[model samples]
Target: MKRDQARRAYWSQNLRYLAGLLLVWFAVSFGAGILLVEELDQLRVFGFKLGFWFAQQGAIYAFVVLILVYVVLMNRLDRRYSRDEEDPA
Candidate 1:
């Protein structure tokens, strides 16, 4: 593909991935934490209250996971797209 076409393709893929990630983040944080708290609270993970834990800690953990995931994913993407700067030969 031409440079412009390659650039557009790169951005399109990035945006699609970002959208999906954000959707999952919102679902885990808002859905489990607030919207479905009552239902989630009844369920237990390691004998802990799911909803309360999600509200208090899970969201933050998920956010951190998201950040790490994004960093790793973007690094791969950059390499795939040949966007990363090369060292002087």
Candidate 2:
């Protein structure tokens, strides 16, 4: 019963993390790129328009970063759960 509770809590945390990362991706890809492109185009990033950059490159970069972050988080979560199992109170 305790083990099941721990597993459920871990999964809940994982879902929250996934949701936040996905929200970021959606905001960058759709919101910045399409919804606010004209306004964002007034800004520049390394010689490229901010909106155009987000549509073309920024979102992809963010997605890759999110993937790495997820992997790292999951690894830490796994290690923590394993450690808990090894040293129970």
Candidate 3:
């Protein structure tokens, strides 16, 4: 019973993390690359327009970063949940 609840809670938290991370990825890939491109274009990076950079490369970088972040978070979550149900409470 307690173990089942702990498992559910762990899964719930995992989904929450996934949702939040994916939202960040969407914001970077779609929002920055498409929605705010014009505003970002006014700036520059490495001789490229910021918006263009984001569209071409920055989004990729953000994705990589977000992936690393997700890995770290999930590892912590895994560690937290690996213990007995008592610790989960």
Candidate 4:
């Protein structure tokens, strides 16, 4: 493929990965933390209310995990598309 096309494809895939991951993070932080807090409150995680835990600690943990996941995904993507860097744009 041409350099321009490869560059576009690489960027497109990177954005797709980002969008999907962000959606998951939003669902966990916002959806579980606020929207579903009432329902989740009835449950418990190590004595703390599930919803409260999610609102406070869960979101932080999820964000960290998401960062790691993004790093791995980007590494794979970069390895696959790094050749684009060699081609003059």
Q: How many residue pairs collide in each prediction?
A: 0, 0, 0, 0
Candidate 1 least-lDDT 10 residues: 80-89
lDDT tens per residue, model 2, 4-25? 7778878898899889988998
lDDT tens string, model 3, 1-89? Answer: 87897799899999999999999999988999999999999998899999989999999999999999999998998887777476635
Q: Rate the local accuracy (lDDT) of all candidates.
A: 0.85, 0.87, 0.91, 0.91
User: Model 4, 8-30: lDDT tens per residue?
Assistant: 99999999998999999999999
**Weakest ten-residue segment in model 2 by summed lDDT:** 80-89
User: Each model's TM-score, in the order given?
Assistant: 0.85, 0.90, 0.87, 0.87
In angstroms, the error of model 4 at 44 is 1.4
| Best-performing candidate as measured by lDDT | 4
Alpha-carbon runs more than 4 Å astray in model 1: 83-89
Q: Return the TM-score for candidate 3, rounded to 2 decimals.
A: 0.87
| Candidate 2 collision pairs | none
Query: Against the true structure, what is every candidate's RMSD?
Result: 3.9, 1.3, 2.0, 2.7
User: lDDT of model 2 at residue 39?
Assistant: 92
Better of 1 and 3 by lDDT: 3
